[model samples]
Target: MKSILFYLPTVGSHDQVLKGMSGVNRQNYRNMLWQLTEQARAADELGYWGLSFTEHHFHVEGFEVSNNPIMLGLYLAMQTKEIRVGQMANVLPFHNPLRLAEDLAMLDHMTRGRTFVGIARGFQKRWAEIMGQPFGVGGTLSDAGANDRRNRALFEEHWEILKKAWTTETFSHSGAQWTIPPKGLEFPYDAVRSFGRGLDENGVVQEVGIAPKPYQHPHPPVFQPFSFSEDTFRFCAREGVVPILMNTDDRIVSRLMDLYREEAAAAGHGELRRGERIGVMKDVLVARDADEAHHWAARGGGFVFENWFGPMGFTESLRRVGETGPIGADYRTLVERGLEWVGTPDDINRKIEKLVTQHDPEYLLQCQYSGLIPHDVQMRSLELWATEIAPNWL
Candidate 1:
């Protein structure tokens, strides 16, 4: 099975997509919401399997909206019936995990069990400063190694506690940043009760009882979004976490998938299957013709570089958050490189065919977000891909 995912861009705000487009004023902001909702509805109809949105803080980057992603997920859930609603990731480190967990649980129920969660240790210094956390000073003691270690440790500790909260009964946890009360809290009514034993009179259960049991058993799937990390790959395979690779080089994606397959076999895990967890992402724009595609992407992609890539310093933040060091190029260069695919249906199909043949990833994430592309243009791209491009593969 080939997994296909769709992203809703951040065009509501004038930061990225609306940079050069005329008529994108305040009223259009409200219009963008309705526009996205309809696009999502179309996705559900067109056989798209997953819908994802990116998360960010502040308005500096054009890729993010002032509205919370969880709220957007809920809205998408109401509009569509089958498509899996996802946050290509919601930043885990920036949020209170418990609140994040609760909101996700509610979203799962709201969507009739079509919720997927993506997590990342955040990498923005300015955002961290806004939150009053220490920003990693450049060329100081807090280099990439130190920062990665801190973030990795925090993620491990948080996961250990969170899984317990979600999958166990009456557990108590004590950590540097969090302390759970004894006697345990009541599970939400919707929470699944996971236990080897039976239930008691007071509707209370033992062994393991999670509040608001998720509609899906063993919890709705957990996804980790990043690129090219050996440790992350090993950990994901061991723990059954899906890894979402983004802005990744083609050769690296092939190598990583091979590595994952080898490790899974070496560890006595069953034959690794595609669409099971490993997925690669691509930046895309499709249009009626190659000229139109190039024109729009060049304009929109530049804004993304200026607002999000240039200012937010993705390269620096990812390095600090334990991603592999320095991105190795300028924002404009990277954006131009990614725009290698902005073309008409035939050109896109051929390029994607090569990627599919070469990498054979479980899934492909189309970049509809990440820059400031207008809602109409974004929707047109989605339509063209779904109607013209995707069907070839299907």
Candidate 2:
């Protein structure tokens, strides 16, 4: 079980960001950058496999202020030595896939192969809807309505364009949502056209190629964020993209794991080892004792689930066994769920061991930097994870 540190990237704690008080100011953002750098440095030295951040925006209330994870990833790469720097997800429907391809290729050069990619379909309404309006789609929340259908169509289309821009030397696309080198457009650069492809003898645009390629062969490792949909599962298996499973129910995860392997075999990835190419993302708030862990959870991880993800309909995995409806009524509820390990270091280890021993996943991604946990508390938990919990698994 290789561990990856995940930063929800909330700028401040509940005390500093409750209600109308938000930390969108330059000074608060500066402090956030500093703290995040320190966290990245710690993870690098702690023998952790990788570190990641979420991609979010419009958090004026200072909850999950991860506006641009790729930019954050580049900065983290400069600060850390070994740990891989990447986003847990960059929403696909909200981006121009061509520009995204160029930025990532440039990042691969800058990071010297320390870069990875995590993709997701947009889920936030505020930014996702506005950003996607030009592209004829909007954010979705699993409602499975027309909005979801449109979002999925555009997301898949953008994904195809991204791959074409990266792997193909010169590619042309005529998809439902996009077309590279618009048919009527003409580029009559004589020096360029005289040299190679992209323009025809009539000086009409034919195809396009992204520059610099990538530091890693074809491209960096690609992963998709929390996948519950069967189509996403099959897509990941087919494309060899690892889907970080947020479904903590082993019954569901176990079945998905089997289904993933079955799909992989059909996709020509034959006979994988148990849990190969699989990842699980779990919430965690560890401390020396139950009381301290409970304290940490309320102000930090619990605040995130209740205030942020809860409204976004993402706290489903944190529900108690045999219970339904709204969750994270209190810290104890988060602790009771299969999705998180919020307790003493020993307690977390007990729960973690149960999962890994049964599933044996290749990657164990934890939400280490959620909400407004105090820096000291986060550091102590980091130490506990490095010294007490991780060694048992690694």
Relative to the unseen true structure, what is the C-alpha lDDT of residue 219 in candidate 1, on a scale of 0 to 100? 72
Candidates in order have lDDT scores of 0.63, 0.81
Clashing pairs in 2: 13-372
Candidate 1 Cα deviation (angstroms), residue 203: 18
Encode model 2's per-residue lDDT on 20-92: one tens digit a residue: 5465766667778888888778878888888888888788888778888899899989988888887888898
lDDT of 1 by residue, 1-394 (tens): 2445545455444442445342244555566577778878887887787887767555433345533667887887798888888886766555666667667777888888888877766555656445425322111112358656666666666676657656654465677556664243444342343433323434443334346756666578877776447777776777667777654455556666777777776777888864356876666788877787766775665445445565555443223233574453443455444534678888888887877777666677766652356667777787888888888776
Q: After superposition, which runs of candidate 1 have C-alpha atoms over 4 Å from their true positions?
A: 1-8, 11-28, 60-62, 132-143, 174-176, 182-209, 266-268, 274-276, 310-340
The alpha-carbon lDDT assigned to residue 69 of candidate 2 equals 89
TM-score of each: 0.78, 0.95
Cα misplacement distance, residue 334 of candidate 2 (Å): 1.7
